[model samples]
Each structure stands twice: as structure tokens, then as C-alpha cells.
Target: MKANVVVIQALEAQIAELDARLLQQAKLRPEYLLLKTMPGVGEVLATIIMLETGDIDRFAEVGNFASYARCVKSAHYSNGKKKGEGNAKNGNAYLIWAFIEAANFARRFSDDAKRFFEKKKAKTNSVVATKALAHKLARASYHILKEKQPFDAKRCFA
Candidate 1:
């Protein structure tokens, strides 16, 4: 127990140093600011999104962005019969983690987000509910990055 605590403290100290350095060297871009306006995103999430998605114009549509971020389900259906699954590992893993983290933060911090999540959870399980919220957030982020605009909860929630 004592050794574990010592290791944990060492890791935390290293993480704090890294965070300080990133803050010093990181250039806050316009898109970074725009994405940060999102409900759950802060410095870390916004930075990861901006860095991973180098060019917002590269994605032609929100669906494409969501797919690339692994926000959407990858099931195959033919003639209204469910086929099989596609390669689920085909997209950016970091974005998936970031969006899920953002969704969790949103659920805790925003009332509207909590309601949306609850509505989804009523129909599905917890994992699906969280993913649905993550998907919604991913779509909103797509628009935010593309338009360089702040997040609009009215348009998003409605």
C-alpha cells in the first residue's frame, strides 16, 4: 500500500509537470476556443479534438465527422435484416475517448444534458445512453469546428 501510494504520487507529479508545460507552449487557436464553448469540453478535451482533427474542412458532413470519431454505431443491415458488424476499429480511438469523457462531464454539469441522457437511458442501457449523448456532442462539435461558432444548446437540444 505504501509503495502504491509512492508510485501514484510520482505519476501525479509528472502529470502536473506535463500539464504546466502544455499550458505554456499550447497556442489557443480560434477553433480551440470555439470547441471549448461546448458543454463538457475544457482545455484537455478541446486540445485533443483540435489536434486529432487537424482540418475541420476535411469532413464534408457531420455524419462523416461522427463516423470518423467512432460516435456512430457500425452495424450493417440489408433488406431490413441485420447483417453483421463492420470493423469497429476503423476510426480515431482518441476522439471516442474524448467524446465519452465530455458526455460524462456534460451529464454531471448541465441540466439539459442530464435530461437528454435520462431520456435515452429510459429506452436503452447505460452504455447506449452515454454513447448517444456522446454522438450528439460529436455532431455539435462538428458544426462548432466547421463554423467556428460557439455551442448553441437551443439548436442542439431541440
Candidate 2:
């Protein structure tokens, strides 16, 4: 039993080491670092953003990027009346997941982000609140990287 336990531990360590190597090989580049510098972002989410989005130029505008992240609401309209449910399943799933994680982190570490999240949640569900925060983060990321400027919390919140 002790030998089996040792083997299991060794396997777990190997898996972790491989994961680190894969992340390193992912090649997040510079923009990813800027994303990482955001309040809620970390290496994992940064990598996801880099791998999933590739060049930001692919998006004609930041709004396109935001839509690709699935952060925007989808509404169906027919003759000025609401139609069937619009699809909410577009863009990179990994990016969406990363943004959600970033939002959660921001809620914990950033006072402004937390306030916004709380306010949103007061009126909507927790998921909506998180999505709102994530959308803000995503938009900020696009502008900051485009302008080659560091993230500014005041401007971001404003």
C-alpha cells in the first residue's frame, strides 16, 4: 500500500510538471502579460486569452471581441416584437471561462470591481453580475493593449 501511495504521488507530481511545461510552451507573448496585469487575471487566464484569441486585430473592433467572448446578451427580434431566444453560444469558450475567473478574482481584490459586481447582483442573478464584470475586463483589455497603455482602474471604472 505504501508503494502504491508513492507511485500515485509521483504520478501527480509528473502531471503538474507537464502542465507547467505546456503552459510555458503556450507562448502567451506580450499582450498576454498586459492582460495578466489586470486585477483578476493570472497566468492561466492570460494563456487562455492568448491561445484562444490569437491576434486582437482579427476583431474589427473591441465590440466584436466582446461579442466573441459571449459577454453580450443575445436578443431575438421580429417586427419590433421579441422573438425566440437568441443564441448565447458564440466565441471562445475558454476565453469566456477565463473572463469569468478574472471577474471572480476582481471581485475579491478590486474594490471598484466588487462594488460594481454587488450592485449588478442586487438587481440580477450572480451569473449576470459576473458576466457584467467580465465584459468590463474584456473591453478594458482590448483598449489597453490597443493603445499600449497600462490598465488604469479609475478610467476602467469610469
Candidate 3:
């Protein structure tokens, strides 16, 4: 038990050091500041997002960004008939994790996000609702990064 505790402490220290380094690097990027303007996106999340999504302009549209983040459903359709699923694992796994983390935080802190989450949860299960919220956040982040603008709750939650 003592050994386990010691190992956990050492790992935490290493994680803290790495997080500080990431923050230092993220400070040089404008997108980090932009992403921080959104609710639930603090230093860690903003850094993860800015680092994971390099050159937002590479995505021509929000849908493309969302798809890249794995926030959208993946399905193969042929002639309106449902076929096998698409390559759901094609996008960045880190991004999906980050967005889901942000969604969990946003629903707790932001009223707009909470309302949106509740509405979605009413229709679907909690997991789906959280994913929906993550999808919304992903799309919002795309615009925020591409346009170099702060987050607008009205525009996003509306």
C-alpha cells in the first residue's frame, strides 16, 4: 500500500510537470486564449484543444471539424438503407476525450449548457446527451478557432 501511494504521488508530480510545460507552450498560441473564453474550458482543456486542433483553417467547414473530432455519428448509408458503420475510429481520439470532458464540465457550470443538456437528455440517454453537448462544443470550438473569436453562448446554445 505504501509503495502504491508512493508511485501514485510520483506519477502525479510528473503529470503536473507535463501540464505546466503544455501550458507554457499553449500560451504562445492565440487559439488557446480563444478556447479559454468558453465555459468549462480551462487551462488544461484549452491547451489540449489548441494542441490537438492545429491550423483550424484546414477544416473547410464546421461539419468537417466535428467529424474530425468524432462528435458526429458514423454510419454508412446506401439508397436510404442503413448499412454498416463508417470508420468511427478515424478521428482524433484525444479530441473526443477532450470534448466529452468539456461537456461534462460545461453542463455543470453554464446555465445554457445545462439547459441544452437537459433538453437533449429528455429525448435520449445521459451518454447520448453528453455526446450531443460535446458535439455542440466541438462545432463552437471550430468557429472560435477558425474565426479567432470568443465563445458566444447565445449563438452556440441557440
Candidate 4:
């Protein structure tokens, strides 16, 4: 038990050192801070989103960003009958992870977010509700990055 405790402490110390080094090395763009204005996003999530997104102008539209983030569902329809979905294994997995993490944090930390999630959860399942929230956050983040504007919870949540 003593040896295990020593090992765990050493690992934790290493992790903290690496985290500080990453913070020092990263060149945080203005958009990184703007990304944090959203309900859920913190330093880590904002950094991930900003770095992974690269240039926001590359995405022509909000839907394009959402699609790239894999927050939007792929659908296949034939004669108005739901057939199947396209390849689900497309888009940036990292962005999806970040957005989903943001959504969960938003739900836990903000009353507005919790209310919105609850409303959606009442109509749908928890997983679906969370995805919906993530989708919203992804689109909002795209606009925030593109416009170089901070997040507006009213515009985003409402």
C-alpha cells in the first residue's frame, strides 16, 4: 500500500507539471478566452476547441462547423421514409468530445442550461438531450470564433 501511494503521488505530480508546461507553451488566442464565455467551457475545453478548430473561416456555415464536429446526425431518407444513416464515423472526434463535455458541464453548472436540458430531457432521452445541447454549443462556438465575439447565453440558450 505504501509503494502504491508513492507511485500515485508521483504520477499526480508529473501530471501537474505537464499541465503547467502545456499552459506555458500554448499561445492562447483571443478566441480561446471567448470560447469560455459559454456556460460550460473552461480552460481545457476552450483550448481543445480553439486548437482543433484551427481557422474558423474554413467552415462556410454554422451547419458546416456542426457537421465537422459530428454534433449533427446523419440521415438517409427515401420517399420520406427513414431508411438508414450515412457513415457515422465521419468528422472530428475531438470536437465532439469537447462539445459533449461542455454540455455536461453546462447542465451541471448553469441554471439556464439545466432548465434547457430538463425541458429537452422531458421530451427525449438523456443521451439525446445532451447531444442536442452539444449541437447548440458547437454552432455557438463556431459563430463565436468566426465573429470574434464572446458567447451570449441569451442568444445561444434561447
lDDT of 4 by residue, 50-130 (tens): 989999889999999999999988998899999999878799999999999999999999998898899999999999999
Instruction: Provide the lowest-lDDT 10-residue window in model 4.
Output: 18-27
Ranking the candidates on TM-score from highest down gives 1, 4, 3, 2
Which ten-residue region of model 1 has the weakest summed lDDT? 20-29
Clashes of each: 0, 0, 0, 0
If both were scored by lDDT, which would come out higher, candidate 2 or candidate 3? Answer: 3
**Candidate 2: clashing residue pairs, number:** 0
Which candidate, 2 or 4, would have the higher lDDT against the true structure?
4
TM-score of each: 0.90, 0.83, 0.88, 0.90
Error of 2 at 83 (Å): 2.3
Q: Which digits, one per residue and each the tens of the lDDT, describe model 3 over residues 1-158?
A: 99999999999999999988876665458777889988889889988898889888899899999999999989988999999898878999999999999999999999999999999999999999999999999999999988899999999998
lDDT of 3 at 113: 98
Instruction: Supply the TM-score for candidate 4.
Output: 0.90
> How many Å off is the CA of 12 in candidate 4?
3.9
Model 4, which residues run further than 4 Å from truth? 1-11
The local distance difference test score of model 3 is 0.92
What is candidate 1's lDDT per residue for 11-115, written digit by digit as tens?
999998988888678776788988988889988899988888788899999999999999987899999998999988889999999999999999999888899
lDDT score, candidate 4: 0.92
